[model samples]
Target: MLNKTRGRPRGNPDTKARIAEAARELFLERGYKGTTVRAVAAEAGVDSALISYHFGSKQRLFGQSLNLLCVESTALDQALQGDQAGLADRLLTSVTSLWDATAPTENRMALQDDDTMRAFRDYLESELLVRVAEFLGGPDATERATAAVGVIGGLIFTRSLNPIRSIAALPSAEVRRIFGPALRAALHARARQH
Candidate 1:
């Protein structure tokens, strides 16, 4: 016989957001290795288990805390699902759509915030780049992921922050048409081994 608890676990409706906010503050202050799940829960005034329930692990909580850096996994999956040659186009379209949804002012502000930018890099390395490299599954997958992200990061920065008139004035489709081939080349590059 097992002792069973009845009903779903009860928590504040805002528990997830609260936990994430607390986590972001701590992570920015202490860096990834220094921040603890217990500290985040205490900051948020939630139980430690609630953080696990909502985010699964500290790494995931870190990713969520950097919400501004997120790209929907479904979107990335959809982009990667198609023909090999179209991968760059699909990915650019997916990412650009998300960027287009946010106001340029918001993008600029987020990019300018040193703490937020650091969080973005952390999320890119720990989450996005790792997932992309694993999905590619080759000896050079990490290299390809790095190149792809570099290209995309440059595109985002030029469009949102520095605002190169030539790049920024063009529509997303046109921008994709011009840059997609370069991105595709980066994505498909195989390292020349000695």
Candidate 2:
């Protein structure tokens, strides 16, 4: 027999979906620091262990919940072979779109939606980052990617702190007007250093 769940009932696919969705919503609303397993289970209407069972742990669950659609360039796995200009365009579009799509609509758990946020330093050292860095080029890719992802993810995550919903809204030209030069500079610097 399945383990008698402790906090809430056992979950099926529907229930699992609810839990994951709830976890994402609440984590975004509360930030990783503020959210807890109990709270996630409550929001999901499933036992807390079900969350553990489905996701292994809070961090893993959080990562899984954040598996947003990836742009092809960023998905390269290892190599900056993609068109640099195209990669820049896709990166901005995907990030901004994901940020916009983070709205806590359907389930609307007592949590604001956010595109995603890793635990900063911890996530930076994570396997996910490792793979993403490899996609940028490899271990050496860190310097190139770090600045770009940091600024982009920071913008998306920090917007959550604002009371205003549309604060993140910006035209592509404007975004390019700002980060484009800096990112270009960063890539060049990395190329020189490497």
Candidate 3:
């Protein structure tokens, strides 16, 4: 029985947005491990080939799945540029709270799953760290800030997988109690040397 429910229909700009939006919603819900390109195409009400045409490939689509770096990077830059006295407290709270259940565990797993984390690492090291360098001071700050961000980000990424490993559940104030002055002094001292 050849059932012809051909998915060919006239799609507009709005329709394209809907398709991408549907794919993103379903992907995050079911996960990259579970959702198929065909399924996303179905949910989006477009041809599977359209998904490929628009996004190129599933891995490329996944990268476009969210716009996160803008918020993540901006928050840190803002905190770093803010009043020095409460800087670490603000940074800790921002980083900790941002990590809480916001990123789907599957997204982190997506990194390990695809072998593209190296690409992402390189991008972050070059682009993201460069932005941090400009915001904090200059090139000298890049190395230190990149390493520090990596440590904090890695810790949070780990905590995402193992809920019990998350000591972030502690009050931001408490976490800041230890991390605040020490980090602030060091970074502030680093900045002042400019």
**Which candidate leads the pack in TM-score?**
1
lDDT of 3 at 151: 49
Candidate 2, residues 1-194: lDDT per residue as tens digits? 66565644534548777887887787667655667889999887777877877776666666556443221223232233465545555555555554455552311222233335333334434433454466667445777677666665455444433423544456545655666666655543455542
Q: C-alpha displacement of 193 in model 2, angstroms?
A: 5.2
Stretches of candidate 3 off by over 4 Å are 1-74, 84-87, 101-107, 114-116, 161-174, 189-194
Q: Per-residue CA lDDT of candidate 1, range 33-143, in tens?
A: 668899998898777888878877776687568655334555676777866668788889977886677666666665676886776666566666776777677799899
Question: Who is ahead in TM-score, 1 or 2?
Answer: 1
Q: Between prediction 2 and prediction 3, which has the larger TM-score? A: 3
Ten consecutive residues with minimal summed lDDT in candidate 3? 66-75
- Which residue pairs clash within candidate 2? none
Q: What is the Cα-based TM-score of model 2?
A: 0.48
